[model samples]
Target chain A: MARTILTALVSAAVMGVGSYAASAATLDDVKAKGFVQCGVNTGLAGFAAPNASGDWSGFDVDYCKAIAAAVFGDATKVKYTPLSAKERFPALQSGEVDVLARNTTWSINRDTALGFNFRPVNYYDGQGFMVRKELDVKSALELSGAAVCVQTGTTTELNLADYFKANNLQYNPVVFEKLEEVNAAYDAGRCDVYTTDQSGLYSLRLTLSKPDDHIVLPEIISKEPLAPAVRQGDDQWFDIVSWVHYALVQAEEFGVTQANVEEMKKSANPDVQRFLGVEADSKIGTDLGLTNEWAVNIVKAVGNYGEVFDRNIGAGSPLKIERGLNALWNKGGLQYAPPVR
Target chain B: MAIGVTNVPERSKSSGSIINDPQVRGIFYQAITIIILAALIYWIVDNTVDNLRRANIASGYDFLRSRAGFDVGQSLISFTSDSTYGRALLVGFINTLLVAITGIITATIIGFLVGIGRLSHNWIIAKLSLAYVEVFRNIPPLLVIFFWYSGVLSILPQARDALALPFDIFLSNRGVAFPRPVAGEGAEYTLLAFIIAIAASVFFTRYARQRQLATGERLPVLWTVLGLIIGLPLITFLVTGAPIGFDVPVAGKFNLTGGSVVGPEFMSLFLALSFYTAAFIAEIVRAGIRGVSKGQTEAAHALGIRPSLTTRLVVVPQAMRIIIPPLTSQYLNLTKNSSLAVAIGYADLVAVGGTILNQTGQSIEVVSIWLIVYLSLSLATSLFMNWYNARMALVER
Candidate 1:
């Protein structure tokens, strides 16, 4: 007993000393490491999963790359850490990753209590239900006594219960820990309905044995504004990341395509010139501890937001999600950037 | 007496002093350790607080009482997006328990059958069991879950074209819908009858055992107990007007409209955990049977015991002595592995805690709760197993 006490005391002392030394800014340490460790999902097709050649591509993936471009001027300067929903926040809290660009929802508690800051909404989604077409279910209200297969540990679960309860309907929930299981349960007739963010439903539907057999309910029960998140405390890093996203929006607004970025550098318009580093007097990039051409570099590396979305989850892609809410402000969507000047 | 005196000065020594005096060094080392530990703990706590404060994040469990504005995919109890964080977590805990219990029961039955098969005289049975164990054991549990869920389950028929199974069960790509029991007014009387029957059966079992010991004759206690347990409740049901019915599932235009539905998350986790843990349990069972010496069975046979009796009376009891300890570990492992429910969204403890943590940002509190719950579960299980093992152990003369 005495020996055990002694060992415990010794270890406690060591930990105390160790933690004291580790209280410094982790952002600085990340900068020195030359790569931002970004946590992402395993495989959501267009979210963070690997392609055929194991290269990460998607709107979420580009967000991380854009941050890398802004910080180091090299889009490839990032290490991707694949995390499950349970592991995502813990990874960020433990300093295992610098940024989480996965399709995580932005909520008040996460922002205030979890010590994380959601930069901006990248995808606007809502909780929706999908059922087999043979059931001919047209609305969520029709799922009175349905067995709903839902992924656990998500906003979708709450939305499901709320929707049912509000309608005075009873349902059984078949909960899975992962999206794949929910998909499986729905497919195997283990559940009567599968519900999640509509985008996720579309992604899942594509992999179904008979894709045309299922139909998503027309009603979107809950709003799910998905965004990238970064650990709080480093104001400078937060600004850099938040504005990296803003830069994308700003680039799109100023008609700065990757193909025309060079030509636009010599434009007569001062806002366009200032954005492309042709006229560096605005000092926007320098204020964030970066060069005036940071936005230019980001666009050159990953293109604008629309390009990234189109290549990933848009109509041109397999997921084929329309840019209804994710379109630019001028295009009648929620994406708006604070002017760079 | 003739030895030369080499020491010039004698050091001061206590009367009770010895070379290996534990009091002297033990106290000294313990004090040093305590001081070091105290310092370390203080530093870590200080660092955490400073870090959180610097990051402008509050660290506490107070957020658990806040409204959990998010939704859960599945819950046994009623929950809403406007529910408290505490309620959300409760739902998650229930989901975890559901999966763990179901997995444990199924895994045990499968493991026993496969274990017996592994020892069968028939080469085919033994080989099949071996192959089952090897294939499942070699693969990761997560992959197995995925394979069952996405690879197989997702490809089934749609809800409208559900493949009807026996007993009004419907199977479709969406999920299986089945008849659910509806308890009526006389159900209370039936439950009471069941309890009474169970008590009577226990008493009779003791009496039968005593009678057998005295007369050297065995009574069919198993059949008697079964009859008492089932017959009494069933008779009460008939006498009370049979107040039990099932709500059968019905097909609708878009989905199955009425019936009880078991979701895919439970199915995949249940299947995966059972198959994965069965491999380990099978190994334990095989070792247990092997541990029983051949002489014990031979002795029983020589005493005119039938082959079945010899196996049961001689081999099984002895095998159980070796099996219980490892079996307990397997049970604990299955319970812990149930935490993998996060992978398939089964709302197990870990997954629920994760949701709460994400919503509340109470990392310290959430992690503490997790550690405490899991550790206590581990301790409780081990304690129960130890007690059981002691009961089954060989008694010395």
Candidate 2:
């Protein structure tokens, strides 16, 4: 009798899986809500952290603001919900957030099985190891039989295991669920090494008890293409976010920064005129269902791509991270955008 | 009697009369309750199905076979990132059982001592036990965990400059490292003797109780059992040429080389849980003891029984009736409280499950597993405790 009831329950549950999945009109929802609900990291120094007055300002935070600027013409039309690494995907899946701009790596499972669309990469990074200076370990190969501290629920954990196995090295991982716990464990000498993204290493080092004592080893283990993601099946909303990202990179290539945007808009170059919406029929913005001056709004709110980078995490900030691969294509870097036409 | 009696005819019952009958009303209410309960269950199942469907999340146990692809800090069983998600959870389950069993043992011992101390005649002893109980019980368990984890353990000296203990034991912020025993050849004979000693002790207890009942002569059962259990094991070791030695830890460039090191994660979790739960157990003990009447002790004294004998013969056995029920709940609470191991990065069941839940996006499956594991653990504990209570209950002739 009990077996019959359980069978009936399983059939009912499977029926639910067979039904039509809910899909919301994200653009209309955002318009009705009057603000873009953006998901961000809980607290990562150079990526996303709130200041004294509780206003979030960082590299990822800037992308969220840029999208808000493109959509509503006012960058402040965004509500930041700080989510942990595990919570980010679920929040987006449930439509709790319209856009997830957290420093999440773009992966195949996330894009396909999780049913989300990732825009272009915002920051390119790779996994690396950091050891205390006194250990005299100059490279990743030296970390043999070491206990490495890493945060769980991240690509970093997977990469660490793969790197060790590939090199035929033995190491124990002291895994923590939260980023802060991992940092504390490493600082307390519970582990011989700390491993994560080199970008994250640079940011996390400053918060350590003795920052100068640790140095990141030179090893780019895996590609971590951090990008913004949106729920699938919303073409108009996806196009808007994707084009906004392209416009920022193009603005950087055209050298149209926030301070000189107005002067650049009046230039004789047709490429610049079309991009800044000054030309008679600059319809690139309208194609994505955004205003003709959408790029102008993005630049005005959070400057161009280079300006935003410098303001939040580049040499202008405390992190002082160099623009290695983040520089423009003409300057021997990977960041490039297609023509506005 | 015959003169006062009058004959009367019985009245016929109508069909409508059954509606007002008490038994009929009871049946009506019971039927209504069962129907309502069934409907409620059906409604919940429907809502869950609709939600999962709408969210586009696959719901099944099939996800358990997928690669876990994540590392746990500690595992009692062997594990790797390439292991199945099911294996990862099993490793976590074993770790949970390990900590809960150890914590339960340690907590009960400390709790009994403190409970007895609270009633001591010495002013300082009573005050100290009372303060310990009040302070630990009043504060949140999580706070105590953090106080040990981040505040005390993290502040210890580096692994290179470990505080050396006797027998090549080392203490540092990383962990506590001590010599691990290696069983040489013929150690199995000693192990076999140990088991034999345990079995003999059990039979001896039963025999001693029977002798006391039949002959009215008490055997020295405690000393005899202790001697048999320890003496057999010791003699076996000596006869086998003492084939057991320690693999002592040696100081290294960065860490201890040979010792078995218990990580700070497990240490903090075990200590916090033991101290926090011990406080509540102590209170339960005090209440159980106080529940025994003073008149019982005096009655024993009237029989010329010594004070210690009076407590053993008259007070404790009866006090156990009050202590057992609450003490069982305290054990269950400690097991549930072990879930806070996640906060301190202890690789207990819930923490490991949480990591898998995030990695696979299988929140529903993971939550269902947690519910099942905790439910089973609590149920099994309650069953054991109930059996014990039955054996200890007062009997009437």
Candidate 3:
């Protein structure tokens, strides 16, 4: 009797697998809802943290705002769903959020097996370690026999393990579920080392009680090309999101800013004219199922990618991160965009 | 008078109309109910599976064989990041069992002490126990865990300036590091002697009981049993050469090196679960003792039994019949509450499973495994407690 019931239950569960699976009209859904649902980090200083007034503004938040502007022509036509490291993927998978701009790393396992579509890396980060200056540990190699604090369920945790194992070093891991907990634990002296992306280290350091007391180690253990992700199987949505990133990069390369985007529309440069939809019969935005003014709206809403970075995490911000690999392709960086034509 | 009746009415007889028959109606309604319930369950499962598949989320237990690629804070068995997810989960399971078992033992001891103290004639003792119970019971277990973790343990001094205690132990914010025992050659003989001593003590206990039954005189059974167990192991260790040594922790720049250390995560979770569960267990213990008849204690006193002996030998035995069932519940509660280890990153089953689920995106598979493991743990605890309860139950002639 028990075996029969179990078999029946299993069969019934399998039968339910694809009953409500097909949902490719994310754009339409967003249109109907009148806002883009964006998943972001619960609280990270420069990438995606809310201010005291609960208004989120950061490098990642700009991507979310750009998407909303592309879709609805208004940056504020969006809602933020702050997620933990463990909750990000499920939130995206379950359609609880339209897109995740959560400083999430793009990896093959996540891109393929996890059914996520990641493109156009927004932030090129690498895993690094931070230790108190008093420890006199100038190099990651000296991190052997140290207790490292990290957040659980992140690529950083996996990379830390692989790095230590490859180096044949012994270390203890003190993992927490939330980023804030990791920060607090490390600050409380529960661990000798803190490991995460280098950018995150710099960003989080400012929030530390003694930010100047700690220094990031020089070892870049893993490539963490953090990007915005949407659900897979929606090529239209994928194109829209990936191209939104490209448009921002192209705008930056074309010397557009939030203050000057409208003025640049009258420029005689054919490429700039076509990009800002100044040229008649330009199908760039329409091809992606958006208005011809989509790029203009995006640039107007959040400026270009460099502007977003500078305003949130670069010289204009307290993070003061040097845009080393994040600079434009011609400027010895990796941010390149395909021609709009 | 009833036996004189020529015919007796059938208890389950029906009238001419089948709808009027209660038995038939009951069967008919039950069949419909069963069918409805089965259909509802089938619909729910089918819809959920369909939704998951449509969402492109893979659901299966096959990911267990993959590399965990993550390190746990504490493990009783040998484990590393290279270990498979299955092994990581096993380590987590063992950690859960470790905390639950230790928490249960400590809770019971504290619970019994406090329960008796609550009834103490001394007002100070009674008030203290009451205060302890009320304070713990009123707060949530998660808050208690945070209190110990962030409020207490995190405030400890750093590793480089660790507080050194007696016997080469070190206390720091990282955790308590102590000397770990490493067995040397010939240690097997000492272990063998310990096992043999246990077997001998069992026989000695039987002999003493039988001797008392026959001679109506008691032997010094406690002292003899203790001697057999302790002396045999001590003598064998000296004869075979003391084969156990301590690997004491030495203070280092980063942390204490070369010894066993219990992380603060496990310590906080265990401490929180124990204190929280002990409150409920104390109340159960007090109620059990109170449930025991007053006559039993008075009768023991009349038999010239001392007050302490009367409480232990008479009142307590009867009280246990009332205590064991609820005590089992408290044990199960503590075990389940150990899942809160995730909040503090104690690497218990739920925390480890959560990491795997996130890594693999196998939410359904991981959730099912948790349900099965927790259900099994609860059932096993219930089985053992039921057996113990049976032993303590009254054996009426």
List TM-scores for all candidates, in order. 0.82, 0.92, 0.95
Across B79-167, the per-residue lDDT of candidate 1 in tens digits comes to 76678888877887788778777887888899989998999999999999999999999999988987876754547776777899999
Ranking of predictions according to DockQ: 3, 2, 1
Q: Candidate 2 on A1-341: residue-level lDDT in tens? A: 12212222343454343222225567767777788999998888978999999999999898889888888899999999887776776667656678899989999877866667897888888888899999999889978778899888788988998888789877888887678888888888888899998899999999999999999999889999888998776778887778878888999999899998888889899998999888896777777767888899999998888988888889998889898888888988778887788
lDDT of 2 at A60: 88
Backbone clashes in each candidate structure, one number apiece? Answer: 39, 0, 8
True contacts kept of each: 0.44, 0.36, 0.58
Of candidates 3 and 1, the better by DockQ: 3
Query: In order, what lDDT does every prediction score?
Result: 0.78, 0.83, 0.88
Question: Which runs in model 2 stand beyond 4 Å of their true positions?
Answer: A1-22, A278-283, B1-56
True contacts kept of 3: 0.58
The runs of at least 3 residues in candidate 1 whose Cα sits more than 4 Å from the true structure, single-residue gaps closed, are A1-30, A44-49, A120-143, A146-152, A167-226, A280-282, A304-335, B1-42, B66-84, B87-95, B98-139, B143-156, B171-177, B212-220, B253-259, B297-309
- For all candidates, state DockQ relative to the true structure: 0.32, 0.35, 0.45
Candidate 3 Cα errors over 4 Å, as ranges: A1-22, B1-11
Q: Estimate the overall C-alpha local distance difference test score of candidate 1.
A: 0.78
The superposed Cα distance between candidate 3 and the true structure at residue A92, in angstroms, equals 1.1
